[model samples]
Target: MSNWLLPESLADILPAEARRIEELRRGLLDLYRTYGFELVAPPLVEYIESLLSGTGADLNLRTCKLIDQVSGRTLGVRADMTPQVSRIDAHLLNREGVTRLCYCGTVLHARPAGLLSDRELLQIGAEIFGHSGVEADIEVIELALASVKRAGVQHARVDLNHPGVLRSIIDSDPALADFADRIHELLGTKDVPGLTELGTQISGVQTGSIQALIQLASLYGTTGVITKARSVLPALPALHAALDDLDVLIAALPGHEFSIDLADMGSGYGYHSGVVFSIYAHGWHDALVRGGRYDGVGRAFGRSRPATGFSLDLRKLSSGLPAAPVAKAIRAPWGTDAALVDALCKLRAAGEIVVQMLPGQLQWLDEFTVDRELVPDGGTWKVRAIA
Candidate 1:
């Protein structure tokens, strides 16, 4: 068998891409700090039980698990950092009030989904625990939008939905369970015909409501769609309240664009209890960032802290981002003068990446095309050949 191999859905982050990702990561970390979110770095590996303590079945299934030889207990490579943060809040911090924690790291998932079809993912996000108010939700949403903008993603839309409405509808008819999942999928795809067909199989499915949701998904304009959705789903108080909260958030963020998906915009995580939202950009059909309130998830760890946060798929965002500006090579002066070495050291110390040539390799260095040249004079260096 061939020795060279890599697991499926996993790949290395090589030079240029890795450097660009690092720069983007540093920018996001600084932004998070400016927003008053304290940074935290949780261990990459954790006890399997603790790691999977509150994460739902879907996430548990996607977690990579193995026996920890040191402790003789099962350990899991974290699939998501949010759950780890929750554990930290519940166990480590042990403080009762709200806390804002930010993190940037690699989360390993066993299965790939949608745009995140990878075993290893670069995740950067924050979690606000111990707050349940719409204000907390608004803060998370605003931060999410701002972070996307900071990442240079234009034309990004934040789609908002409430799981309670769908839960209520699903509770009304137990038989609708089978069709419910399909309906949510169709809603995401904006498959009106598919939803209509699924609606036929379930009793009291409210074809009109389903149609309204489908129409809302199709609605692409500004805040006008919110008013139209309100007109369609008038009786759903939870939905209306959610829309009101959206309006408050929208009013606060005049510069950003948002849309409301009244139908059950299903979430990957079952833990999300209240208002759920996802951020999408022009090129990606799936969300680049997603999060929602998980009040119960906290309680599972005996904390009962209400929380709302989001994690950005950095890989997807990087893929959608414009290529980084290429680095220019610096040509060293021709002669073994002390000034040339001093200049090279200065450039290297100034954080400029440099390429050095060995003795007699200067001819090859000249043959190698470069973007810039460094000529040493009496005591200073001159920059030439910038092109």
Candidate 2:
């Protein structure tokens, strides 16, 4: 095997894609700023305890562990930045009012989530701490959609799932507890055969509930899906409340395409307590953006504040973008003339990309090779376009 072989699912990003990712990052961060969200950066690695403290056991499983030579304690490369952000809101900043925070960075997951996903993802996300109400949830969902819109994904569809409703179904009957995991797995993957078998395993009141839940796995298409669930599912308080939450969202976002997937079960990131949403664009097979509420994620730090947020991999999001624009740069050759140096600096300050050439070095930047060159004519610096 080649010594340079990268581990499975971990690879480098090339210049073209890297430029697109950075552009998306800046635009999304700017959009966050418009929503009054402040930017924050957390260290890539942290004490395992702090990093994995409150997110969930799933986060712990994905975290790559290491020994800190200086402290002689185990540290973990962050698999998710949510827990770290929670710590900041609850422990460090401890801001009194509702805090709006945004972050963009690379997170290392031990395994790739799917065939299309990467092990190392450039995560861009926003968090709202100190808000538990559904209004906060609405804001998060809106922001997620807005970010994708800003990324130029025109045909994105969002599927909203409420696990609490299913949680209620599972908790309502004690006998159904034995088959919960299998049921969740079947429901999430839409395994009708497995679900049919699971339905047979349950008896009495739980039997009817299991069958009703199983049928929902196939009930996804349009807004009517939500209405159908309200009409068909057994009337439970949790399900009723969750439907109302969905109602508010549907009303708030009129015209946008959204579907309700009640059977969307828990994942490795376990703390999501409310409506979890996934956005799928036309070309991408997987979700381009995802987030939900994790009310008590900060408990391990000190306070268990109400929190909700959304995150999208910059690479994945950019993959759905219409096209990557080429970089525009001006080539500056080596010269002793003070005017040439001053002109180069001025061009850079004015937001123009200026690439200065070194002595005896051939300028071979073919990509983004603009015809425009900085040349001096009649003792004056000017940008002249070559034929």
Which of the numbered candidates is closest to the native, going by highest TM-score?
Answer: 2
**1-387 per-residue lDDT for model 1 (tens digits):** 576778878888766667778887899889888878889999999988888776667778888889988889999999888888888888778787788899999998887765557778899998888888888888888888888888889988887776665555454455666665665667667777886677676776655555554565564455676677666553566666666766777787677667766554555525777778888888776788998887756665777788889888788788778765567577664556777777788888887655665557644332234677786556778767765
Tell me the whole-model lDDT of each prediction, alpha carbons only.
Answer: 0.75, 0.83
The Cα error of candidate 1 at residue 203, in Å, is 9.3
Per-residue lDDT for 126-217 in model 2, tens only?
Answer: 99999888988889889999999988889678888877777777778887777766777788788888877776766754567767777678
Runs in model 1 with CA error above 4 Å? 171-239, 333-341, 360-369, 376-387
The lowest-lDDT stretch of 10 consecutive residues in candidate 1 is: 361-370
Q: Candidate 1 overall Cα lDDT vs. reference?
A: 0.75
Model 2's lDDT to the true fold? 0.83
Model 2 residue 18 CA deviation (Å) reads 1.6
Residue-pair clash count for candidate 2: 0
